[model samples]
Target: MRAYETRRGARLSAALMLALAVGACGGSTEKAEGEKPHAAAADYERGPHRGRMLRDGDFALEITLYEEGPAPLFRLYAYQNDKPLDPKGVQVNIALTRLGPKVDRFTFAPEADYLTSPAIVHEPHSFDVAVSAARAGRTHKWTYASYEGRTTITAEAARAGGVTTERAGSAMLGETLPLNGRIEITPEGKSDVVARYPGRVVSMGVELGERVRRGQVLARVESSESLQTYSVTAPISGVIVEKNVTVGGITGGQPMLVIADPTQLHAEFFLYPRDAERVRVGQPVEVTSLAGDHRLASRIEAILPTADLTNQTLVAHVPLSGPTETWRPGLGVKGTVSVGANAAPLAVRTKAIQPFRDFEVVYAKVGNTYEVRMLEIGRRTPEWTEVLGGLEPGTEYVVDGAFLIRADIEKSGASHDH
Candidate 1:
């Protein structure tokens, strides 16, 4: 079936070619320089010019300055052979203009021996590209230009914010290891808070977003079955963290008055099983809350057993010794747990990592460019992922809008093909 299809296509192509040839003979032609014009039917005897048609395919060419050191070299594929001309002996016309004025012409020594099949050409040509600067007192300006067929304006007057690029040399490939999470003081351990047991709240003593102290009567409840009155008191002596029981609502053994020791707050985070192995009980953990600009230096207090059933996460509890004013529960934060191993990995913000199917991806900042790197994730918590491979420590990657940066890099690489 495939061979039959191929033959059918070839026959169709041959018919189209014959029709084009006949139509070209019927078209008008321009007389040569100083030649007498032929009659309408007499010009049909002259066939198509091979020079113009052969220049249509494409030329893989590179242009560089002969003397200007460190100046950028422009690489382009001039689509010249558009007129059905054979490129075997076609002339190549190159002109250079600076600041919209003609400066020089480059005539490449054409060789038919360098041609390849499928009409693709790879050639490098260098010439002295210099523009005479107009010196006005202490200031002067210069320009650069190139042309293939028509006069193409390559550059314009000097200005900032133009297309500037550079080639990067050898670079270090570092592995990115994600941190556990932002340390947060668990709300349960803080103030003198208590839960109302099997009772319906009849009234509330405190309003929402209000502060209550230890032993404070925050609400009143009644037994759901027996109608026995009960007063919901603060369990621990701290500010009210939450008021779970609403007035006139029945709560069965639920926490109604949430109180904590405001001054004794600590951060709790989760690590993956792989990362949990690196953390010790006494290792220092640098805690930073997203709710504020402050950071607290704390230590890993415990590595809890049993994975969190909902997430399969290994929990790491860190106690903060700093002032508790900056730390709060339910606020998103992040911190790094110092792994005592000799091989410390690079850390990146958790927001920058994107999950794809079963793996994770992060945008790594390579010099001034960003690249999409597939991460070998060993462990992950709410705020960080442990990088088993594919990143380095201390290197800054795009934490904000990393996916956007990756998209832009891919788009830029695709545009270079043109």
Candidate 2:
């Protein structure tokens, strides 16, 4: 299944290759006189400063992104004929067109031995770069692509691949306490049918496992004192779980039938000493069957004051509603109780988070393109995760099928080359 999904993603990627070309920065389509096009930044030769070297005859400029400090900034080293050139002697301007077609322009000023860009280079560092420099009445220009953690897919293809998106915004993040329990019938939902007076059973009307309604005749008993026959009816509407009498059997002292209402059920979850203090009545809980195939949303209906002598744990009862076909008495269940919640200024769906390289990332969407946004995360719950940094609040991000984007980017061999 994984291989087939990957193939589908590859097809989608192929369909967007043409779109990528229009925004591609590799191999210059236009250049100045006597200037030649260069390969992408990944293939460019690194100068002594470890920055990509762009050359036009004897004049060359090495561009490096300096990030050792608080923020990333652009730095340029000028050279002539393999020898260092005076920084002040060269004038340079750079344009970076990001995935959203948003352009960031930077002008370089001579700083120490190299020209520096005062503006900070934002994260992702993936863009189409255009560099122009002038010195000694001569001009040099170059353009190349430097893309990483980015991929493009047509809208049609995205829908076909189940790709979905949502805007990053405020959300309530909850803190939960986990507990284990089992489904049980409520006390009021069960009843034991018995004869009103000592008598002999004349006829049994219901069998084990048979559903019955309240006041339905369960057995006909012949009273010993009156020496007359009377009907014993079900006290509650439920299924007959136990039948203790038959025709011609003596009743009165023992229950003739035991009926239990399956619909009125509750999950009794055990809270250890450490977690008991945090749980209270009326808090919401999410209960799932032991097999995890069924789930029900409920709230803590009550908490027993006394602890069980065997386990020394208090019981928290969560009432279950809706269809009870999957929830049977004695079936074990898992529960998550919401103890508290806090509002987060900016958050994203937890499902959108994916591991990219060394950081936890989510793919931000713009048109047909998607790029990684490494996040600084804070409090997290199963539904929403607080985003402390690396993403804008109103930005649209992939909420599903993010793995496909990551796979496509990896297939393109996008790297962190300087």
Candidate 3:
């Protein structure tokens, strides 16, 4: 992307390019010199060639510009009437007003063909250029826009072009540590229904996978020690995932059913060796389902006693919160834990950023005008990037469809360096 000059300069560049192309493809028939259009005396009266011109009685100063190495250079040509006048003791100063309501002023020194500004110029060339020169005990000032790399479209047209705007602002962005997690049974969520004493199972009331409440009779047994009947009850309220007792089998003190709370499944997030040191209890976490649709919020409640020797990854238990949809034991998940935060003075969605003029830029919308602004960026994340300069807070800018605007501006040739 390039910084564009004013519309007048753009047209002049196009005309110049067209002339060059036509000259390259000229036909055999040569027209007489008389057939060619000539510059009349009046053309010199206002000063010939490009630039903003100012005339004070007999003295005329025209400020023309051309790109040198990195940016545009301004030259001031002084003319006494229609003939060239030596700059001699003439002094010139130029003021450039750009976006952000900022101004850059440059003083000129006499060079070979014209007076050149001393400063190293840069892009975002579009601006209101004010030129003032003092000579012959008189001073003249003129103001004209060098509107390059800028475009204005009506709101309706912008809407038709799918342009959307957002105010530049600040946001809290945290450093994310990526993790892989899976739902599994926690010690607290597991319950074993066992016989208190050795007995012969007489009646079995509950089946496998059945839900039971605490103190509910899961089976009736005849105790061998006293030859009496006893009721075996569920110890915890949960789903009965396992049942091993038979109606006629004699028990030697063994578990009858295994109950686990499926509704509140235990989730463990695995961290690599590099991230394990930074992970701690109570750090914020986001658990996303493998489908990347469902999500639940939780924190690092505890680290598992052992690490996976095969992978060298440690498991952090993150008990999920709220109701879960399609979340079951052994379900794979993604975990993003926040280890630190970075607050920026200004930040925007990374999608809003575009490459322009060798810098990362986002189209800033000032009313109906969309102008290119070079940005100084800092720390960034996949979702947001920090804005260091070239933008102000509360300024509305294109956040969506900025790429389309870039295409349109390129097609318009507003900022093209001919």
Candidate 4:
């Protein structure tokens, strides 16, 4: 009975393998045949005019795009047996199907030497084309694909590749002023420890850079007049930045120690004469460290009325809030002050912008396909860019991993051709 069961199981396994093989072969064959029609244009023959050449026996047609004039327009030339054919004798029509399955139809009119399309051929010269010609009561038709700045990836693949998208729409565009500054402790956050009277330091308990609490004993001072010793306590909880007095050192009016609270920090940005009028207190400022490893969102707290006598630059104080463990006094920082703002009808994430051909574009996604949208940009900030034209509102665009899509499209050998 055991032997019989084993033989039956072997037969079942063999059947399953055969079924999978047949399914795989059928799917592959179907996919190849389906792609052939679209793949033909990439391998189409080119005529002398550098346009795609479509031929049937002794009759041939050459299509070219004439863009040296006002706008891009299609020009067609006809031939018979390697000799020129009269453009008036042949009637032609062309259809272009774009990525969104939108179709554009064009009709040709005969000119002096060739037939020219009256309608302009829009940019991205990337589409599947269908051509029809009628001559002597016979009709000839050919279909091929030409694509550029476009690519198609499966949804699963796009997700795995980190390709994310967001709809393009209204955004607040802010105009900013660039300012350079350094982190500094607020005046109220720093303290200078001094003795009540002229005295000599008896025993110093706290060292430089030591963390101390308010009312904590920091040192023992013996007064020269009273002839007695008194404990000197910290006025504020902070780190000791300067220790001027050592044991047995005489302390008079000078500060014996300086303590600064790191948490009470602010960035001091300098404004030149041109920028002084634009900046005001309460304006939002984005401060970043010189190394760019840290960033904090702050606002201008105050603007000094007087300018520095040396450089004549005014100072704007922007207070840093939240956890400031990484912010250190005297650390150089850069700031962008949002002076003014306007609402733009269409905007996209600045990082989504990519260079495509002669245009700065963002990849608009529809389903599994991605295509470029050339932009006429307006005022731009580091986070968002205003779109003046060339993209429709509410269109989904790639916010991240846009380079991956561009790379895939380039790797597919898409080109700009007539």
**Which TM-score value belongs to model 1?**
0.35
**Model 1 C-alpha lDDT per residue in residues 287-396, reported as the tens digit of each score:** 77664488777777777764457655676777766666566555666777666433224444456776532346664443333334556665444445567665544444
* Residue 24 miss distance in model 1 (angstroms): 79
Model 3 weakest lDDT span, ten residues long: 19-28
lDDT of each: 0.42, 0.81, 0.71, 0.78
Evaluate model 3: give its TM-score: 0.62
Please give the ranking of all candidate structures by TM-score, highest first, separated by commas. Answer: 4, 2, 3, 1
| Per-residue C-alpha lDDT of model 2 across residues 1-418, encoded as one tens digit per residue | 0000111234534543422221221111324334454343234467999887788888888989887999889989999997999999999999988776679999989989999988988877877788999999988888766767876677876777778999999999999988998899999989889789998998887889999999888888899899999888889999999988889988867788889999999999988889999999999999998888888788999998554476678899999887868888998899999999999999999999998888899999988778899899999999999999999888999998887777767766555666
Q: Highest TM-score among the candidates is held by which one? A: 4
Residue pairs with clashing backbones, model 2: 25-145
* Full candidate order by lDDT, most accurate first: 2, 4, 3, 1
Give a tens-digit lDDT track for model 4, residues 1-418: 0000000101112322311111000000001111232233345556888876777767888878888899789999898886888999999999987767779999999998899988988766766678888998877776665556765666665665667899999999889999998989999999999998789899999999999999999999999999899989899999999999899999999999999999999998989888999999999999988888888898999998544577667899998876766888888989999999889888999999999888999998877768888899987899899998878898899997787777655554445655
TM-score to true structure, per model: 0.35, 0.72, 0.62, 0.81
Q: Lowest summed lDDT over 10 consecutive residues: which window, candidate 1? A: 1-10
Error of 4 at 279 (Å): 2.2
Pairs that clash in candidate 4: none
lDDT of 3 by residue, 1-418 (tens): 1222222112112322321111111001111111222242112223475554566666777767667556667777888775777776688898877765679899988888688886855556666666677887877765545555566666665665567898989987778888997888778778888887788999998888788888889898888899899898888788899878789988775687799877777678877788999999999888888888788778889986454487677789988755645688888889888898878879988888998767888888876678777788987876888888877788888987787656546655454321
Off by over 4 Å in 4: 1-41, 67-70, 110-112, 135-139, 321-325
Q: Runs in model 3 with CA error above 4 Å?
A: 1-97, 100-149, 153-173, 245-250, 307-313, 343-346, 349-359, 382-384, 392-417
Q: Candidate 3 at 416: error in angstroms?
A: 4.4
